[model samples]
Target: MQPHQIVSREEWIAARKTHLDREKEFTKARDRLSEERRALPWVKVGKAYLFDGPAGKATLADLFWGRSQLVVQHFMFAPDWTEGCKSCSFWADGFERMVPHLAARDTTLVAVSRAPLAKLDAFRARMGWTFDWYSSAANDFNHDYAVSFTPDEIKSGGKIYNFGTSGFGVEEAPGISVFYRDEEGNVFHTYSCFARGLDMMNAAYHYLDLTPLGRHEQGLPYPMDWLRLRDQYQPAPGKGACGGS
Candidate 1:
């Protein structure tokens, strides 16, 4: 932490106004970038990707759930892992509450992981999340989306993600992929964002950004190095790997 500066009312107002101008510019730039993102060309999906969900086996189009637009969060949970990535869990914490709102907008949001459906269901129950989560265990969805890497790729140092083959250490990474379905039932890959690109989805991080501490992640090996599963926070009772489910 740094020393605080005390200033008169007028001085603080002037400083705030100057900062507000920069904030306005940033807002405009962000809107323009969003427009550009929407303008990006779409690619038709040709694979028969399959997923296991609460309703049994489903195809990529089935995951759309009658919605024209679909948003898939590529959760980093391997088939054998009993728990999901803590960072992804942070993002998932606030997602269930947005379901109806996203539904009203004709968009369906769901999480896809390499873990089996049983594992996903149990974990979701433990976390008390209601959002639809599916398993990509029987498909190439994760690998095709560049979120999952093979052991061979790791051994060969040949995995590529976020448009590059660097700065990654784990077999799985987090990302958001968007899709659109046409009236004729054809599906198109719309847009995808990885790394810190998905930061805006975390409300807690946004609130933290508004404070003087500002995420307080500096000097750490990783920005989220301090993160743990929601139940794992000390003084908070941890419900074991299976939780209460």
Candidate 2:
């Protein structure tokens, strides 16, 4: 944090109005980009990918829950990992509350991870999340989507993530893949975004961007080094009986 620049009311209002104009232009540009994104051609999903959910083994289409559209959050939980990624968990925390709104739009949003169904269930229970989560352990869905890297690829540092050869810090990364189901039971992959492309999903980050600090992750070891699952935050120093505040 830095010292606040105190200014006269008239000066502050003038500066604010200038910034507001720029913000409005940025908003319009964002709207145009979104329109372009929706215009992208969708590809037909040919693979018969299967997932393990609470009910039992299910196909990709079955996970849509009778909806015509599906949004799958590529949660970064490996089969052997004890917990999901904290950053991904931060994103998942926002998901449960959006279910009804998505349902109203005839879209189903679910999470798919490489972790086993039991692990996912236990973690979801711990997080108190109600959104549907499934395990892609039975199929190459994660690999096909470029969210999970193979052990060999990780070791060699030649894996492609976010559609590039540049490696990621972890074998598993985060992403969102959208699908559209037709009346005839055919499904098409509408779109998929990775890396910073997922910023739209985290409402908290956008709110913070309006503040002085603006996410404030600069100089940290990782951009999300300060992030933790909802329950893992420790009390601030001196907030206890000690005089540390």
Candidate 3:
């Protein structure tokens, strides 16, 4: 491939204008799809699911935390897993800043995992996050959303249904489920999405585009191998050994 050339000011302006025009078209199409999505039929959640919160055990209704709307992210953390899934952890990290803004809009956001409350708390402490997280240990909430795998699923070696994708066994895919409460205090499931819908949490894509390497791989999952908690990361030898060396 030919090396990219640095363009003059006028050329830069012209290129930017072309990109902006394309972006505008993309935005219009995105908005139209969103409207279509909003028009879909609602599903009523008949089963009463339980979740473990910081304050203690709570029902699905209680997850609203007095807010009229609730948004739950099914985080990947089974009870026995030692650590949260790396990709899901990236998304969860954004919740700290988003929670306050969501609260102002009268929407409460929380992350639910199948892990025990004690285990979730310990992992959160290790990651140094302040966002609200809860345990769904006693319920089939994850399985219901097609985010958790069952023992039978593991044993069958057949296609396990999940997130509109079928192939080998199904594994937890990051997902978002929304719910709204009516005047009668009945909570109705409004919407849910997985995979591409979770793109808002992807900062690596933005960063990769600005780097020389670009995204390096075509079909791989998001580039999670490079990130680490701020305190846990260390620069490699001769990598950060700059000017003096």
Rank candidates by lDDT, best first. Answer: 2, 1, 3
Query: lDDT by residue for model 1 over 180-219, one digit each (tens)?
Result: 9999999999999898788988899999988989999999
Question: For model 1, what is the error of residue 26's alpha carbon versus the real structure, in angstroms, after optimal superposition?
Answer: 0.4
lDDT of 2 at 240: 48
Candidate 3 versus truth, CA RMSD in Å, comes to: 3.3
Q: Write the per-residue lDDT of candidate 3 for residues 146-212, one digit (tens) a residue.
A: 7787778767776554444653344555788899887677988888877667775567566766677
In order, how many clashes per candidate? 0, 0, 0
Residue ranges of candidate 1 with Cα displaced over 4 Å: 165-167, 236-245
- Evaluate candidate 1 by giving its C-alpha RMSD to the native, one decimal: 4.1
Per-model TM-score, in order, reads 0.93, 0.93, 0.85
In the order shown, the candidates' Cα RMSDs to the true structure are 4.1, 2.8, 3.3
- Model 1 quality (TM-score): 0.93
| Colliding residue pairs in candidate 2 | none
How many clashes in candidate 1?
Answer: 0
